[model samples]
Target chain A: MQKVFEKPQALSDTPFAYCPGCLHSVVHRMIAEVIDELGVLDRTIGICPVGCSVFMYEYMECDMIEAAHGRAPAVATGVKRMLPDSVVFTYQGDGDLASIGTAEIVHAAARGEKISVIFINNGTYGMTGGQMAPTTLIGQKSSTCPGGRDAAAAGYPIRVCEMLATLDGPSYITRVAPVDPVGLTKTKMAIKKAFRNQVDGKGFSLVEVLSNCPTQWKMTPVESLSWIDENVVPYFQPGVFADR
Target chain B: MTTKKILMKGNEAVVRGAIAAGCRGFFGYPITPQNEVPEYMSVLMPQAGGVFLQAESEVAAINMVYGAASTGARVMTSSSSPGISLKQEGISYIAACELPAVIVNVQRGGPGLGNIAPGQADYFQAVKGGGHGDYKLLTLAPWSVSECFYLTALAFDLADRYRNPAMVLSDAIVGQMIEPVELPDKIEVNIPPKPWATTGRKGRGKNVINSLWISPDQMEEVNRRLQAKYTLAMEREVRYQELAVEDADLVLVAYGSVARICRTAVDLARSERLSVGLFRPIGLFPFPTLPIQWLAECGKRFLVVEMSHGQMVEDVRLAVNGRAEVIFYGRSGGVVPTPTEILDRIRKTYGRSAGVSHYRLNPGPEARR
Candidate 1:
């Protein structure tokens, strides 16, 4: 008998420390699978941001550089520029990429850096106990926005895939989700395409994964997945923002 | 078989030096005093088959350097005072990651965006850890256009040698002034393969990662190892050039462009029969203290003249260890002291007063000297 599901060879044997039912584990699996499929496991360097996936270095059996909060893009830019032949990718959360690291990511894409970015937009700061993130939808409640996010006060959610797609440098930009089996499968395809873009020497590819934060959303794992399907997916509709 | 000598500004020399050294990537924003650096690279880098990017902001430029350096490519960035401050976070990250790259700071007057004039006010910032954390940058202070070219090449070599960041600390005057420079031969530079680089993990078992994280114990060990490397660097990399110190009564210590001014003052003081000498530090970090102490033991009075208000003077005093009177003459806030002004001070201090006698006569030089 053959196993239908197993950890990717690129991933270490260490069990993930993510909350049970958190979609981060699923996203991580997809990325690891893509790395294995692309055969870029050895020459790939991943930059982990200061968010939920900060410990990504330990989980991914790749050369990893842990960047300061929101600095994964800048660090990834450095890694990619220095090692042009090496495949570089940054694993960042919504807060890390859209808020504090906005300048880094924008300019990196604008410069058309030959790298890939796996942006995890979970709508809250997961590792820091679920503060409101830049992609937090209107009326969403987090520890920071206890009374639900006020668009007039906190501003609307940032559609990073669309925003970044405006830059001419990036060759590919897409937004995908992992709320259900079908969405998860689509998200995996997007991740694979991002890796393939880098392999083909296409400059700057990104796959923004709209994932569920079960603990932070104050819902059961099933409800969190349902919430993503009902709320997050509609606001940040899944599709390729750019492909050229 | 010899390299040709050409007249060029110090900023231009740095650009040529980088190109000749096989530097393939440059990221910078326009700032006074050193704008010529990027401007020259803009034309030359492309001609030399390199990348030249005029970034939107200093923050973006430094991050671009961070990106290029991460690739293990010979990359560089330049900025002025306030711009350098804006790049501190990236600088710290680059140091933490142990990336090899060159950073040029054509220092102008500052505690803020002070002025676009020549100043050595960034001495402490450059030599004593400009960014946070336990790390030191290999800093070189070039006094002339030739040194600018030579030191920029040295900066790349040193950065690659130690797998560390190196800085070329210039002043507005040095960056702006035109002087004849003998360009170095276009020797082939072998950029070491970064087996540890994060290109990808294709055949090499797993992907490579450049991170600053480890467990508490592991972090401590990493820091300890870094400290040991810095210590070794200090022992081997201390560099300075001394002039006419044998049997001298007064030794003037200075660096960068100010050192050139002090040299002229020393020449004039000798003509006036004051017997003054000069000690110029080339490598600002791992400062040339032993030679300074040796000069002090010869019973020569030391005067530290700088464009800043007595920053490097403190370093001189520390190196002298009270063996000789370490006097200071400085003009801050973008004021460039003339050679005549420094000569006048040297004459007033050393010519009129007889060293140890003056110390006994005047209890505090800050009050009376």
Candidate 2:
């Protein structure tokens, strides 16, 4: 029997840690697939931030460093600067990137660091009990914002791709979702392009993945996928914001 | 570049030592007292084929060190008092992950952004595990320019030896002061390969350097191993210098820049036919507790001198266990006592001229209480 699909060579055989319906698994697999395709699996270093994907180091076969919350960009910068020939990337969540670690991410981008960033925008803090995040949609209910995200109190959602597009430092900036087959294919392309940018010695490149948090969203797997398309997509509007 | 004997400031010596010790990366922010360190490294590191980055802030600087250190590189970061406080969390994470790196704290006065002048107020912070964790960092206190060069080199060695962060705790006086130093020959240090470092996956399995262990048993095991390492360090790494302490009835206990001043005070007191001795600690974390314990058993009174309001004295008091009286005299808020002022305080406490009475010194009655 011919096998139609097999695990990417850049992924370990260990079981994934994300929730059943969470899109973290999809994105993680996509990143590993990209590394394998680039034939740079052995020389790729990944900086995993504190979030639901905190254990990303365990799932990937590449060298990994677990960074403190929001500090993954700075860590990635350090590693890339020290080992210029090696490919380095950071995997961060919206809470980790846009909230607590805004300074590090902004400065890392401004420095035009030669690295890639895999940002996951799940619109909520999935690991920390579904708390309202910086990218949390207005009128969305979370553990902290039980009354739903009121713009008067919580402000508007942050569009990381668009915001980073304004900076001349980054060479490529895009947003993609993994809710469906078509979206997943687009996300894989974006991830591959971002990795290619780093391999080509281009400046910073980032691919923001608008993932879903089925467990945190208190919805079924099917409902969560629809939620991303219905509400999250309209606000986040996945697309290539910039390609320098 | 550190070829032969030359005159340089303590801050300059730190950079020279780091270069000689095989540091390939230096990340730091601009802060007072230690500003010269980064200023010097910025020019020198590039010349030596190393990386020198002035980070956005002290916090970011330490995080940068964390990134570089994860690759098992010989990296370092320098800062002052308030800046060091900003680095505590990052330092704790690095230690918890068992990464090898060196951090230099050229301390200035502080509770908050105190002053640029030299101060030893961070004695507790340096030795007492300033970060929140069950871990220990090897700390070195250099009192002179020569020691500054030697200890910084040793700090890099010790950090690799223990697979932990090592701190070179200095002060403004030593950091800014210029003195002659016989720079040692190019010392070749052997860095054992850390297979656990997150360098690339080439010829090895996946390496994950992390501190978080969600499981209780796993976290407990990690903490237990760290505590054991600290105990082993205390047994083998406790360092101090004892001067005429065997027969003296009074001993002046000090470390870092203040120890240099204490030496002058001891010399002048000895000239006055007073039985004054000096006990200086070189490694502050694996503190010289045993030496003080032995001296206290011999019925020797102690005068704990520092630039802070008696922080190290608490450690001394614990070691003494009431075997002898442990009195303290310090000057904080960026003020350093001269040799004469220190001598007066010594005289007030153990003055043979006044028949060893319970008299007080200047800063006088308020400090006495």
- Best-matching candidate per TM-score: 2
Task: Give per-residue lDDT, candidate 1, residue A94.
Answer: 91
What's the TM-score of every candidate structure? 0.92, 0.95
In candidate 2, what are the lDDT values of residues A1-244, reduced to their tens digit?
Answer: 9999999988888899788988888889999999999999988999999999999988999999999999998888889889998999999999999999988988888888999999999989998899999999999999999999999998999888888888989998999878889988999999999999989999899999988898989999889999989999999988888788
lDDT of 1 by residue, A132-158 (tens): 899999999999999999999999999
Q: Point to the candidate with the largest DockQ.
A: 2
Q: Per-residue lDDT tens digits of candidate 1, residues B1-369?
A: 357767899999899888888888998999898999999999999898888877767777777677677666789998888888888777777777788889999999877879898888988888888888888889999999988888998889888878788999998999999987777567567677776554555566553334455477877776787788788888999989989888578888999988999999989878766678899999988788888888888888888999888888878888889898888999988999888899888867844474556334533323433
Name the docking class for model 1: medium
Ten contiguous residues minimizing lDDT sum, candidate 1 chain B:
B360-369
Native-referenced TM-scores of chain A, all candidate models? 0.97, 0.98
| Cα error, candidate 2, residue B21 (Å) | 0.5
Q: How many angstroms is residue B16 displaced in model 2 relative to the true structure, after the best TM-score fit?
A: 0.4
**Candidate 2 chain A minimal-lDDT segment of 10 residues:** A17-26
Per residue, candidate 2 scores C-alpha lDDT tens digits across B1-369 of: 445667899999999889989999999999889998999999999998999998888888999999999888899999999999999999999989988999999999877878888888888788888889877789999999888888998999999988889999999988999997888657787878878877798998888889999999999998888788888899999999998787677899999888888999999877765678999989988988888999999889999999989899998998998999888999998998888888888767653334434332223322333
**All models: lDDT?**
0.83, 0.89
